[model samples]
Target: MLGICVCLFAVFTHVLSQEAEEPVFYTCTEGYEYDRVREQCRDIDECALLDDACKGGMQCINHFGGYLCLPKSAVIYISKEGEQVPLPAVPAVPVVPAVPAVPPSQPQVPRSSGNQGVSLSSRTIRCAPGYTADEQNLCRDIDECATGRHTCGPEQTCYNTRGSYTCQCPPGYQKNGDHCVDRDECALTHYCMHRCVNTQGSYYCECNAGHKLASNNHSCVDVNECDVENPCQHHCYNLIGSFLCQCEQGYELAQDTVSCQDIDECSFSSYMCQYQCINSPGSYACECPEGYQLQGNRVCQDINECETGTHNCQDDEMCWNYYGGFRCYPRNPCEAPYAKTSENRCICRSQAECQGLPPSIVYKYMSIQADRTVPADIFQIQATNMYANTHNTFRIKAGNEAGEFFLRRSSNVSAMLVLTKPLSGPREYVIDLEMVTHHLTMNYRSSSLLRLTIIVGPYAF
Candidate 1:
């Protein structure tokens, strides 16, 4: 009886082990369904399958074996009557059927067990808003921008997030409640260096006179007026916002500021030139009369024709230099009773012809400028032949009626002719300077005379 009982326990254990080895079948979760073609479980797009999945202006999002309802608008708006209109409240996360935690590579297969199969059950889960289950049963973001289900207006842009979507105004616009409005950028910031002009959603800059807009469109640069069109006739200077006109050294700026006028420098003073003043376009010139030359800018100096060898004096004649002119005289000037003995001396050949006259005469010529100083010693006379025991006295015998000149004896044989008063000319004078010699020990008396000619010039230099 003990052997039979042990064999019966062994048979029962083998039968139970065979029954436990049979394959078990699995059913997809509430939000998932099995794909007959791919032979795998996939998430059910409940939002696409059910038209009435969401209500009250809510957007429908699909998950694994489930669906969600979310508020269509993310922001609030104002009504036409200025009343605030609130958006719908966000719905709670929808219940999602839990997917089976089966290995994808080795899925549970159904095995025949007397025309029936063992099955595994599934439960439900919940996911956050804006998330949907993919084919792999993983949560992902929905592309609201790509889909027409987004509630963003025409002026707004939509962007998708991991679990939600957002609506915003486009560039150059700002959100005002639920509407988009143009933003005044000019009023918000100092964007322009000069004048600022606001446009639709943007702004531009404008410059004042004599300024130009820079490349940046917001800065102003100075425009050089002189470089474009120079209005000055002579010189142009460009300033910060304007230009200046200037004239040359000898010119003056006209009233129009564009023309340069000549300055009459000669009219300012009569002493501009010693002889004559000539006005030119931009300057003045100093001119001299004939036989004269300009010394400096204003003074006139006489030309020495004799010294410069410009005179036409003959070889037999002597040239006398005067201011602005010259004269020629015979080399021997003595005449009539006076006979030429030397270049400047003459003697009376006949005592009867020289009676009551000096025995000898000497000729001398000299020139001086006009306005000579008074009391000037002009000429010196010395006896050529000397005699012993003789005393001499000198005097201006002729040309002394005007009291212009006097003779003073320095030694026994020499004398000087001095001018006592100033004289001005272009004038000439002839004076007889007589020297009377008396023999101190003998009863003899003699007289000699010097014929001097003085020519005065017209100018000082």
Candidate 2:
């Protein structure tokens, strides 16, 4: 009996489980339907499926399962008899009327709910002074810009506010009433130092030819011409707005002032040279003639080949010094074996006739210091081969016979002369010395030294 009751209980539990899995169906209302997932009836939101169900002049407001239609009040007007009246219905032609503000003198009337049931008169409505009633009979700001009602020009912009609209200029512009004008940014600010150009909306700075804009974008600065490839052939200097070229020493700037030319130093009269001046590329050189050398780069001094041991003189000849050269001649040509003495002339083996020598050859060499009390030997006669068998006689005479010069023999072989007076100025004195060598072995005596002219003076402190 317990097993039978267990079987019956199992069957009853299965039937109850099946009924819980499959729910029953029910009829739904006009505005509600059943949802299979929830297994219940839910109200439908008619506002989402279709347009608003509000009639006449009303606004639709949605709720949990339904929507409410609220009536919108029309613009209220006061009658000529001071009685409140409803706004007239709009014509089929869609006419828009200007709604005026409710006057303070009129009595206020409450708005209608739109469900008059034909038992109530039209409801009163109102708006602010500048506000107008929209299609839903609600107060809204009039968009004069969108409706083409604003008096602003093309350059002006219209802005709508709570109850009215206004016109204003755009950025970088100015407004005067309904008109707009462009703003001059260049004149209104510290724009540029050089030049300012005004564009449509802004301004810019510009510089001249040899200038550049500074880092501040306002002022101008000079361009450094030296930094670029300048046309100058030498040194280049950059100025404030220009450039210049310069040359070094011994050079000059050309006509264009950009190229350098060599200066002809030889053209100047003050050149430090005695003989000749030669111009080089950029400098000059002092030159002398043949057989001469430059002294102190200015004076031309004779290159004494005899004293310098550069002459080709034979052992039997003597080198004589000249202005620019040296000459070699036999020593004492008068000492020939056939030399003789006549009444007043000397005869020698004639290779040439003997003429009086010039003053330079007669003196040979001479030098005297200023203000010397002692005697100074300026000339010495060389002894000849005839001196061994002859007795020499000497006589000296001064060109200026003022007792300025006196002669005496220091020894039998030489003579010594002294200047007794000091020279007052630069003056040359000539002296003649005649020496007669008596040939005791020969039959006659002849004077060999005739004129030995000496020059002195031209000395100073």
Candidate 3:
């Protein structure tokens, strides 16, 4: 088996050598003669086909056209003295020192200042993963941006990194695909006092008329017009965005909101006064006339000048008050021709003849109130002229047709006059009382007369 294997290897080696020496062309179309596969036209790999394609001391290397045979070593072998004949000498090649190799983990710069004896032809260097070697034998970062290799848009900015790059937009802009667009902040929200003005990278606020911007710069506040000036004649009231006028106490606001006018209370028919109504600035006053005073604020009452001692009546006359006026009434009545005495009493000269003719009665006037219905003591007379002892004899008569007054004698022999009923109606009556003495010495009777007046109502005074 070993001999057969050896024989097969020798045949394969011979075949590869013959194939290498003579040119072989695969059968294919003329334009596409060479193909990568062996089934078509292609270059023959002699080393692959036969492991020992080259002879001793020769190296086999395949090429596009054919194969190459190179000498593996060219050194001469000198035999020791007395050993044997020395081998043939090959051509000499100059020796050069090897340069230090830079590790693949780091990059290295070329050593330009070494000894002249040192050679750089055999130097080996490598760059780090993120760096590339330049012609100067130095590592440098790649600039993708300068080389037009960045993917940033026209409006974007490109930044070069170590072996990489970056793309971005400006501060107030947003990245939208290839564009660096301005952000519309105003469109996103209302950020102004009254109106929003959007600008490049900024925004502002504005206020309308009669308004002012607030501290926040995004809202508006009403401007108070009344605070700057007094617009009302009396008082000024401030409202939102406007002003109003108001009047003090008794006044009113005019049609114009800025003016105030006085109100005439007297002009209204509801003004209530007893007798006189007086108007003032914005109000009215109620007053009484000469002889009248206000009972309530709205009613009038007659003032009694006589009772208040405010009258001008004489000593012999009486003062009387009516609704709005006063009058003076005489106290007593007598015949006009009869002269009044010094005491203001009435006397007649015919009294002397009546005294001489019979026992005449002299009538004296008396005034009485109708409220005195119970028997009231009228007079106590002690006779002095003719019948001193006939005090018990008396006669009484009332001139009243209604018979309201009569006279009676008491236990002490005194005369009294009484009314039968309390006088209530508007009427006046008279009473006559006559007294006579039963014992007459000169054959003449003594007589006396009394007159009484029953008065009711105001005239009773």
Which candidate leads in TM-score? 1
The residue pairs found clashing in candidate 1 are 31-64, 31-65
Worst 10 residues of 1 by lDDT: 6-15
Residues 110-222 of candidate 1: C-alpha lDDT, one tens digit per residue: 34343232222221112345545465443345677786668889878775543455676764567788888877767765667878887765567899888888887877888
> What stretches of model 3 exceed 4 Å from their correct place?
1-188, 197-204, 208-211, 222-246, 336-461
Which RMSD values do the candidates have, in order?
19.5, 25.3, 31.7
The TM-score that candidate 2 achieves is 0.45
| Candidate 1, superposed: residue stretches over 4 Å from native | 1-189, 194-209, 215-218, 244-246, 252-258, 265-274, 295-301, 307-316, 386-388
Off by over 4 Å in 2: 1-131, 135-143, 155-186, 197-202, 208-210, 238-244, 255-257, 295-301, 307-315, 335-461
Q: Would you list the rank order by lDDT, best first?
A: 1, 2, 3
lDDT of 3 at 203: 61
In angstroms, the error of model 2 at 22 is: 53
Q: What is the TM-score of each candidate against the true structure?
A: 0.54, 0.45, 0.35
User: Tens-digit lDDT track for model 3 on 202-277?
Assistant: 5667788667778867678987867877777887777776667778888887787677677777677654564567
What does candidate 2's lDDT look like per residue over 81-108, in tens digits? 4455543332121111222222222322
For candidate 3, give the lDDT of residue 119: 27
Clashes of 1: 2
lDDT of 2 at 165: 60
